[model samples]
Each structure stands twice: as structure tokens, then as C-alpha cells.
Target: MSIDRLFPNLTEDNQAELERFGDILKRVWPLKAKHREKLKYDIRDMSRGLTTERSERKIDYLSEARFLSPYLTYFLPWNLYRMSRLFTGLELDIPDGSEVADLGSGPLTTVMALWMSRPHLRERRINFTCMDRAPKSLQAGLKLFNAVAGENSPWRVRTVKANFTDHIKRKADLVIAANAFNELDWSGRVARPQAEKLAQHMAGATTETGRILLIETGVRLTGRIIAEMRTQLMQTGFKPIAPCPHVEECPMPATGQGAPWCHFNFSVKDAPTWLQTLSAEARLEKEGVSMNFLYLSRKGGKDWGAVRIISEPFKFHGGRAQYACSHKGLTLVDHGEKQRPLFPGQSLVPNWPANPKTDLKSGALILPNTKEKR
Candidate 1:
């Protein structure tokens, strides 16, 4: 579906709000030559993964504006687009009047994305609770929410000043965390235990039929953490909904005998003018963003013999190879001439033969007569 169909009035509203935000930045911080130079340096540092300590400090420096400016102009659009793709791909059945909660809701970006994805919910008395440790960030998010949803919107919104690791008081119909899991230092000695704790909390905070969406940067460590959490959550009674067609243990975790990590990339075409300007200013490559995501629900018994493409299709002389994950395990499927190209995140239903040949050397499950459609 098109963006206009999925999110009525979102593009127009977003453009107006972005202009207002830009005005605020110009009025409050007036970008001078020195500021521009510092922003360039900070952007360079950020590209090299050297801004984590500065981000944790929470001090309002010029470098911070350098970061926040692009976040509003560039990152926000990409995030909304990504969330829209997830919602559409998963085909989630979110009930009307559902209560939604966002953890680490910086500037309430995810909440905005949710509202944009389900514009019908605006008339249904949905309740949203946004939680974050940064009060200023929450305040900014509230302003953005007001701008997008309006002051007299049917949706009731609330903000909380609390860290995500702390216990939450209320249960919700849908819970979303974007880029929050990767910040928990899950690569340390406490990785497994921390993942288990997070899974328990997510399960506790969701209703029986409610769903949880976790999105992280498509990095190896982040993918590993999500894989570990998926195992833990499944053990606690939740089932994988999207991206994974089966509930079996993830075969792509780093701990699983040096297997490749699980992550996917989505293409972004014709980015917004603001993002293009910011990219040029920061001297960052204008490439499509890669995101690692998981969707889980308390509902179970998904036994469909479906497969999900987990990697980019590798082209050969006259065929293509796709790595797929299913209940059986991870295996590559080779397609013959004139076959359609497969992309990551595309779901497929393959017509398997009564007797198929499996190549153990390459771990390829050759589907000679398989009729596949995405």
C-alpha cells in the first residue's frame, strides 16, 4: 500500500511539523560557522561509533544539537518508513481501543509511527503511554505528538519519566521498543540474564493476544541480542509472529557455531529533501537503512509451512540462491532460470516435491518443482 493510503494526512502533517521544528532550532540555537564546524566533527565521530559516551552524558552541548537536528530531519522519516513497513508486512490485527505503550520513547517517534500506520484508531479511543528517562526528550515528544495528533485528538496520551529497565505498572495491548534493546549493554557477561529479564518483562506487560515489536539497528551484536531474546521469549510462552516463520531456536545467533547473524535491509527511494540536506552536511553516505526487528505475540500454534527469505539473493549464471529459515532449519534454496528475484523480509510458500534431493555439502535444499510466490 502507498504511504498516503496507510497514513492519511501524515506526509502533510509531518512536513508542517518538521518546518516548525526547524524554526525552533534556528531560533534557539542559530547555526553559525563555528557550530557548523563542530557539527561536522560530531557527525564524523558519530559515524565512527564514538558518540556513545557523549550521548550518555546528557549535557546540552552544540554537538548534541548537531545530533538532534539530523534526528528530527533525517532519522525520523526513516524510522517512520521502517515502522510502516513492519506494520504492513506483519499484517497485525490490532483491536480498536487498544492501549499502546512505548519504551524508551525518545521524542515519541515510535508512537507517531504507530498512529500514522493505524489512522483508523484515531477515532477509537486508543490510549498511549510513553516512557523514557530523559524528561526533556519526553517533553519534546509530547510536543510532536500534539502537532501530529492535534490537541483534541481522540487518543489519550500520557508521558512517564522512568527508565525502561524499571518495572512498569500497567499492561498494554501493544508494546514497542525501537533502538532501546541495543543500549542495555547486552554484550557483557550479563547478556543472557539481561535478555531473559527483558523477555519476562515484555511478556508480563502484554495481554494474551497483544503483540510486542522490538526494532534495533542492523548490527551483528544487536542481531545476536535479538536472537537470544527471541529464544527466551518463546520459552516464556510467546510466539514469533513476523520475520521468523517458525518457533524453533534461531539458527543465526553468533553463539550457534559461528552462524551468520539475522538481520534485514529495506530500500528507501527518493528520501525527503531535509534528509538529503542533512546527509550532505554530515558527509554521510546516503544509503538505505538496515534494521533488525522481531514481532512476538502471546497467541501460538502458527504451524504454517512457510519460509522467509533472510538474506539478499546471490545471482549466478542463470539462477539465484536464497537463504531461508523455517521450522526444519536454515537452508539455501536454488532457483533455476527465469525465476523471480527474492528479497529479504519477503515471505514465500514453496510447493515442495514428494521426494526432494538435499545437498549436504552446501546445505542446499534444492526445490526443483517448487512453485513459489511472495
Candidate 2:
């Protein structure tokens, strides 16, 4: 089932808002037929900003409604879907009346995803603050938020037109940075201290019992930057909550000798038709959405025994081998046909036999013995 289907009513409501937002964009930025043909090219170029040179990362068209229209139609839905998956998979326990802050919250994507994922919080009097460096983007985000959240909603929405890394001064119960952390200068050649400073700031801004979430493009450099940030935050006493089973040093970094970085894929089969169309027109992959994310908290109480599947299962003659990471370290686990299929980001506790009479079916094994029955 699609992630959005988990909350049918809420998903419908969110879709309605998305349609309304799209309509507003079209009316505000009516494009001529000739200009419409160039949208795909424009989107293609804009998409390259994630890995392009720092000077080329800025999309000046972001301030124009004409460009923003296509972006909203093509990118927003998939991002929302990814955010929904992240929130659902992590299963965060945000309390009632919590103050949530989203850094680099372009067009309010993360906030909208949060609302859609946790519809129960709509009536709980929450405060949502969105900060971005782009004034126009913040304005657009505010409009989207107001359209989705009517005047009667209990959410107190606020938008700040400032760079989140420099202007954020208040603490929040839940802090999120989506598709923004990679913008910080962390290239191998340049050692920008801003990356560590931002991590420290986020760690310090989180309230006790609060959680911090960071999402970035599922690319090699972004994954490495996230791993470095994880190490920095861990040194400051923040423990990883998801995608990592233990608070030890990250084993997979881009600098490692061909070691795979941490990332996950979310199926986008249920994305809106408009997004799918634009994705096809832009010649982008439409089946799966990839992202690298980290969830952390000051408290450390994760189930260390639960191991995370880090790679796809490799099928053999009578069984499969899956690479996984656990508190102990990385291991290749052999699984019989009776064992459940393992996907990336899935966590399972291994049941090892201590005696001859112990039942192995009660819990899955991390690595099955070669002599064991397949």
C-alpha cells in the first residue's frame, strides 16, 4: 500500500490542498504555450543544483511565479510523499501542543508533510515556524500553509524570512531540516566550520526530550556530510534514533574505500499525476524517491539489538544473504526461505539459539549457521 493510504482521510485533504495550490499557481503565473515547452528543461537545470558548484546552486527563478509553478507541480508532491514516508517510518512521538520548527522550509513542504502524516495533531494547538532565506519562498509557503490550514485550525503558523542557520534563536520541541543541510559548504577541498556549528546549534536548540530530524538528497557527498554531522552531534551527547542502531562512529562515509553510504528509497507510485507527468517530461526517474535522513535526540534508549538492513537481499540457491548493521557492527546474514524478506532501513532483532530446545522461529537470526536447515 502507498504511504499516503495509511491515512486516507488526511491524504485526501492534503491532495485537495495540493490541487488548490496548483490552481493558484496557474492563475497567478499563466504560461504561454511556447514558454510551457521550456519548463522541462528549466526543471532539469534546477534539479542539478543539488550537486552543482556552490555559485551555481542558487535558482534565481525561485522568486518568479512562472518558475515556481512548474516546481510546485513537479517536485512538491514527490517531496511531500518522501517526507510522509520519513515521518511514518521513524514513528516519532511528538507530544501535544509541541512547538515545531522547520529550517529552510521552502514552500512549507516539510510542515505540510508533518500535518498529513499526523492528522491527529491538527486539533492539539501546535505552533509551526518555517524559516528560509528566500522572502518570496517564505511568502509562498505562508500562502500554502494558510490555504491548507483554515482559520479555525489550532495551528499557529509563522514564517520567518531569514537564513535559518544564522537567524534561528529559539528552541523547539521538534526541529526539522529537509533538503537543506547539503547546501552548507562541506566539500572535501574546503573545510567550512559552519557545518559543525550548525549541528551544534541544532543540538543545543532542541529541548529536553525533543527530537531533531535532518533529510538530504541521497547522494554520496550528502550522505558523507550527514555522517560527519552525526559524529559531531554524537560528541555533544545527541544519540541517533533511526537509520543507525548505535551511537558509535559512522562506518560508511564517502571518503571510505568504496563503502556504501547510508540512504533509503521511498516508492512514489502514488504520486500525483501532474508530478509524474513532469517527471517523465524532465526525464527523471519516477518509480522511487531516494533520501538520506537522520533522527536524533539527547536521550539514548534505542533497541540496540534491532539491526538495520543496509542493502538489498542477494538470493542464492536455497537462501538469501542480506547485509545489515547492528550495534555490534556490519555483518552478512544468511536467511532461509522461511525468513521474511528484508528491505533497506528495516530493523529486526536476531534470535540466537542458546540451547538445543530453543525455537528459532520466535525471532529471526542475524547469521544462520552453514549447517542449519535451509
Candidate 3:
């Protein structure tokens, strides 16, 4: 069975709201057709500032209308779609009247994603504090959040103009930072120290039942940073709640040359056609979105003795294979031609052999458990 079968809720009731939000973005965008060319140009510049060119690090999106408009209309909605999909799959155990905080909340992207993706949360009264250094961004985000939340909503939101590591006065039940920390050390040279510092701040901001979710673009350096953060948090009594099966040292190599880091991809085929068109017009057409994320909690959850598929299927001479991480270590799981292929990030407790054979090409131990996984 594939991932959708194991998690039935994944297939149902997700895309409709996302599509509606796309329409909402279209209606709310300030720029008209006459500004289409300029919007595309701004989008290109935003892309360069974000993904490339370390010299453009000081570029501020909220301070300028040209950059902020593209960010709000194109980048924000796309990120919201990705975040909503991610939130849909996780079982975040938030109670009624829980206090939540969003760190480095660029236009409240994570909060909005939780609101849209997890409708069950809507019934519960939530107090949210969103923190960011940019006051204009916070103001704009509040406007957009209210427009989406409408009247008489059970949730209350407040904005704080502060740095990412600034002290949050109140500890929250859930803390979120999405695409936030990567900006601190973009070169990946000091990921360890940066992660350690971030872990300290995050630990101080959350309680015993608190859960912390951090997400970043699925590049190699970001993966290393996330993994390093995971190690730092685990050392401080936090435990992995998702995407990681064991508390043992991370098997995915983060250092050295030509090493493959762990990350997952979500298809954008289900995204609204208008959004896709808009993306193409901006010359940033995306077939799928990829991210590196880690969800950690002080309180432990069920321990699934399983292997998480980390990569898409690659074909060998006799069968197909994919990279997986488990308590044993990084593994290469081989599937017979007749067996169903597994999806990335899907976990299963496989029937293990006493002594697994190693594959020469991938340098990972081969798991021959080609039998149908539950």
C-alpha cells in the first residue's frame, strides 16, 4: 500500500480549501494586469534575493511595494499551499484555548496554513502571537489573516515586532518557525553553532507539552542545518515526533562532498490552475515543492519501529529501490518488479533479514522486504 492508503485523511478534504485560497489571493492582489510585467520582474528579483546571491541578503520585502506585492501574491500563497498540505498530514495535539506562537512569521504564513489546513483547530479557541522584525510585514499579515479568518472567529492574533531569537514573554503550547532560521547562516559554515543557539531559544519558548515545527527549503545546506538542529534539541530532552524513526544519530550524511541529505517532495499538480498559470508567468513554474522539516516534542508519542522512505524510486537491473532511514541506519530498500512502490516519507515496519546485504552502488544495506507493507 502507498502513503494515501495508510493515512486515509491525506486524500480527502485538502485541496478544496487550498483552491479557494488561491482564488482569495487573486481577488486580494493589489497589482492589476497593467503591472503584470513588473510583477514578473519583481518575482524574479525576489527569487534571486531568496535562493541565490548572498550579497542581496539585506533586501527587505516588506519595505517596498514592488517586492512585497509579488511576495504576498505569488510567494506567500505558494508557501501557504505547501504548509497547509504539510499541516494536514501531521497530528498536532493542540487543546482548546492553547497558546501558540509563530516565530519569524513572515505575513503569518504558518498560522494561516494551520487555520486553513487543519479545520478541526478552528473550533478550538486559540491565542496566537506572531513575531517578526518587520512591522510592515506584521501589519500586512494581520490584514490578510483577518480577511481569511472573517468575523467572530474563535482565534485571536497579536503581532510582535521582534527578532527571531528575541525572548517571547509567554511560553506557548505550540511553536512554529517556517523558512525562518535558514537566513541566519546561509553559507552553512556555522550550522552547528547557529542550530545550538536556535535550540536554546526554542526550548525556552515551549512547555512540556509543547511541540516545535521548523521547515526550510529542501536544499542540501538547509537539510544539514535542520539535522543539526534536531541533534541539538534531542540532546536537550526533546524527541522527534515525525519523519524520524529513531533517536539514534541521523543516518543521512550532512557533511563531506557528494553526500545526499534527507528531504521530502509534495506534488503541486493539485494546486489551482490559476496559481500555476501565475507561477509560469513569473517564470518560476514548479512541478513539485520540496522541503526539509523536523517536528519535535518534549512529550513522547507512539514509537513506530519503521523505516521512512527518503527518496523517490530508482531502478536497478533486477528491481527498483529507494533510500530509507531506520533504527538500523540508512538503508536501500529493494522492491521486486511485481510489488508496489513506496512513497517518500511513508514509514513501515518491514520484515528484516538477520544479516542484510549491502548494495555496492549506493553503499547502503539492502532491505529485501519486497512483501506488501501494511
Question: Who wins the TM-score comparison?
Answer: 3
Q: Model 2 over residues 1-374: C-alpha lDDT tens digits? A: 00111112225655555445555546644678877899888778767654464456554345666557556656776777677766665667667688888888888888777776667777788888888777687777667666666668888878887675665566799888898776666766553365677778887778888888888868887888788878877777888887887876665655665676777765665556666776888998677767888888888646546566666677744878666555655555666766555556766665544532212422323455233322
Q: Which stretch of 10 consecutive residues in model 1 shows the poorest summed lDDT?
A: 1-10
Better model by lDDT: candidate 2 vs candidate 3: 3
Total clashing pairs for each candidate: 0, 0, 0
- Tens digits of per-residue lDDT, candidate 3, 195-308, equal 788888898899887988888878887788788888899877898887787887888756656777888876777776777988888889998888778889986545666788
TM-score of each: 0.83, 0.82, 0.93
Q: Which stretches of candidate 3 lie over 4 Å from their true place?
A: 1-13, 186-189
Better of 2 and 3 by TM-score: 3
User: Candidate 1 on 154-239: residue-level lDDT in tens?
Assistant: 77878887777676677888888897776567656799898888888888898877888888767787888889888888878888
**Which has the higher TM-score value, candidate number 1 or candidate number 3?**
3
